[model samples]
Target: MILRRFFSSSFRLVSSSSSSSSSKLGGGCHRDGFRAVSSMPEPCQSSPLSDDESCDFDWDSLGFGLMPTDYMYIMKCSKDGKFERGQMSRYGNIELSPSAGVLNYGQGLFEGLKAYRKRDGGFRLFRPDQNALRMMTGAERMCMPSPSIEQFVDAVKQITIANRRWVPPLGKGSLYIRPLLIGTGPVLGLAPAPEYTFLIYASPVRNYFKEGSAPLNLYVENEFVRASRGGTGGVKTISNYAPVLKAITRAKSRGFSDVLYLDSVNKRDLEEVSSCNIFLVKGNVISTPATNGTILPGVTRKSIIEIARDRGYEVEERAINMEELFDAHEVFCTGTAVGVAPVGSITCMDRRIEYQTGADTTCQELYSTLVGIQTGTIEDKMGWTVEIS
Candidate 1:
């Protein structure tokens, strides 16, 4: 299930390849000039799996899991602040030192986005620029160098194009893109790594939660805290996620879709869900938690805020108490994975509160609008969709 694409040689400081004479470091790998740094084969020049070959898998059975595609894009940066050229490679395993910074000190970051197949047979990315900016912020916080917004966006587009055959058919699913930045260099003490790896991989996926379009059941977790103020909560560092696994696993075991986390300081204000942002609808008003330091600024959450406001609904970004959420007309969660999911009920301290969820609900309307824009069925007046063929 874990497929990776790795070159032959490890991280080393080397001069640019002869074919990359016009290429420059710090931006991105030029499409025509890119070459592998080691004695590995020229991956960029290689073509992806043929359409017939890629059709071996059942697209309908695809879930939100890793089923590696044909190619992946990888690049590296050294301690001297110079980024080497990037290259595409066949999918497989990567070797890393036991004392790697990411292994010992958790010096890493990652991003997630998706590519939707348009009705016209082309592919389009949904606001990848936001993910690029978020990754840059995470990199700065994690004490690592990052790709520029331009480099990040370009790399995503290149990899999507290279693996275009793996993209699911229209209305089937989307190609989930994961861009990871890890400290590959060894580190004995507690400091940044001497080198870093920036890689992107794709997987065809459907819904995040098993409920799909059905309403979700959430348990309010008052025992465990997700993130604290002035902590790594504001940034999407790799270190911020794993600690919540036990709580999420427990919640799922109890038949709940996910757990709703409360603010660490007050333990009363609603923070966010395990992997999504929380939103509450009261009549014609829609409100979400203000991203102070604990909540992640999700790309889908941002889009929903704008979309709701444009639809003549008053949107508020402020602290939301548990009592307010229990009394809201409608409740939902938003993220890249879970587009927009309504909350059927919430169990807080053994007291259950339920809300109405149906096709005509606010969350469903928002989900439809967002999906329409992403799949190119609706007009993208905001210029959010970026077409890639």
Candidate 2:
């Protein structure tokens, strides 16, 4: 009945409620006049699964990998056009030309967030509006049009509701939602694409690291860096991620969980990990690398900072050096995937320092409060979560 109610009248909620001028376009897909969306009727929904029933797949073994769901939300527009409307379709490959800007020039952006099945069997999303705003920022930097914040959040909710059955049972994991904005149209010149597409897909995922919730062993990379000043590093673009693969691969081969990149210019100050943000805790003070045109401002990192400040911890956002990092009493990593993970040890060159982990530590307390607020175990005093239903 929830699915039925969603599809029947509120399916057009984004289009009908939007006041942006982009909503003026006709509600249909037209890919540069080359193709049109399929006109077939949407598949009928089956009876809702009861709480006693389990998923078809093994829920206990869920990991941070792609496990395709039943549906995805897609919307398309020209480079100069606006994101008007989108629809949910079956999950499958999309058609693209060899000259597409995304393939040729790497014009794309992506955002990650998750939906947790609460203890009472309802679903909640953690600060998806922030993800939408971040995606809009990335779209502007990548030279592409973006969905309005309302549209982006609505599409995410639509896709989640469409694939609600795929959401892992409470505490097992969560449905990891990925929203992608890409240049889909052909381009022969070294410029922005003539068209773009906004797509959202999801998978049920558990811990990002193989070690589960255990503390991580990180390697400080002096040879490679993740981002720099006045670059796409500040924005979440496709081009910012691939260049760090070699460094991450090399670190993993050396038995480290991940690599901690430094400022490319100085190669001394802390930057971030391969896919997450880093935090250093010394005494009662918590410090993290500032987002000064070189660090990707993580949503989890922002939330954790506020939560820490609310809990009477002194939080600082500024440049942090490797020496200070090594001297810190505790360190932790935050991201949509990693959540809040304590860093057990950091190996810089030949010097290795292990931090305090496990119960009664600052990392443990923050992790508990963060996850508790997310999963509805604790009060959401900050009003950060959005209920899916």
Candidate 3:
């Protein structure tokens, strides 16, 4: 698994964004988190059936598969105004134009987060506000409507609560939430969509890294760049990922797990994983690539930063070249979906750099601390967790 920075920069957005003037939820939860959106489509009105009667699944032992539940949350906007309240409904297909902005020009943004089940039987959203705010930033970069933090958070809570049975038991897994904002308006003229849809769906996933806790081998292409200076490396647009599939496929056929991309401009600085944030633990100091607009700002990355600061370990976010990485004692990656992945070695053009995967490394410490908080095994000092039984 890797921590691909969430918000890579974009050459698309050239405008400035002002902060939303609201603070309803605690710690900027209700405000400054999402963009203002308009009202939603006609809500599907129906009472949730009992758990036994509603659709059921083997929540446990749920490998990474899409077990579609019975409901989803949806909100829409146009070129005129902000977003509106969305409604929950039976999960199904969505309407889109053949020439929609997303279909032709690829104007889209997405966020990935999960809701965990506590030991006491309540559900919790693990720092969803961060995910919400990140999605808004991505939307802004894509020239799309930004849903308010309240709308995003409420939609997730409502949709997940509507299908609480999908949330796995303690130590089982989580209800993975995927909130998407896309342009559905018919436009082939290369302009922003007059219509947009903000939709949320949940999937029960045991772990994103199918090969968990094991060492991974990464190939450094040093050829394909995930994002570059002044590029959309800082946004969560879908177009960024489509380009990496060929490289990853080529690596996998050779028995590699993922491809680590270098800075596009210099080919010396480290950017990030295809889906996670990369970190290096060299003896005592912790090193991650500086956010130069080409890497996603992962939620896990932020948590690691706060945790490292509290523990007083030397943490530096600066330029990390490919040369400096071979000298590191250990390396790991973090993201919302990928969790924390410890990299054992990096292969590049017949050369490889192997590192230790011992328990003594700070990367290990950070992983333990993060997993502890997410699984309710450790106290959350930063108030990053949100309960939703």
At residue 9, give the lDDT of candidate 3.
Answer: 31
The residue-by-residue lDDT of candidate 1 on 1-389, one tens digit each, is 11223333442222223111111222221222223333334322434344233344677787788776666777777334655566666654666778888899999898999999887777899999999889888877777777767667777876776677778988889999999988877779998777778888888899899987788999999999999998998888989899999999999999999999999977999999989999999899998999998999999999999999999999999998898966798999999998988999999989888987998889989999999999999999999999875
How would you encode candidate 2's per-residue C-alpha lDDT over 306-389 as one tens digit per residue? 999999999999999899966899999999999999999999877999999999988889999999999989999999998866
Superior candidate under TM-score, 1 versus 3: 1
- Output candidate 3 Cα RMSD: 9.5
Model 1 backbone overlap count: 1
Cα TM-score of candidate 2? 0.90
Q: Please name the candidate that would achieve the greatest TM-score relative to the true structure.
A: 2
Candidate 2 residue pairs in clash (backbone atoms < 3 Å): none
Q: List runs of model 1 lying over 4 Å from the truth.
A: 1-54
lDDT agreement of model 1 with the native: 0.80
- The TM-score values for the models, in the order shown, are 0.87, 0.90, 0.85
RMSD of each: 6.4, 4.2, 9.5
Question: Over 4 Å off in model 3, which ranges?
Answer: 1-60
Error of 3 at 325 (Å): 1.7
Candidate 3 residue-wise lDDT at 147: 76
Q: Top model by lDDT, which number?
A: 2
Q: What TM-score would you give candidate 3 relative to the actual structure? A: 0.85
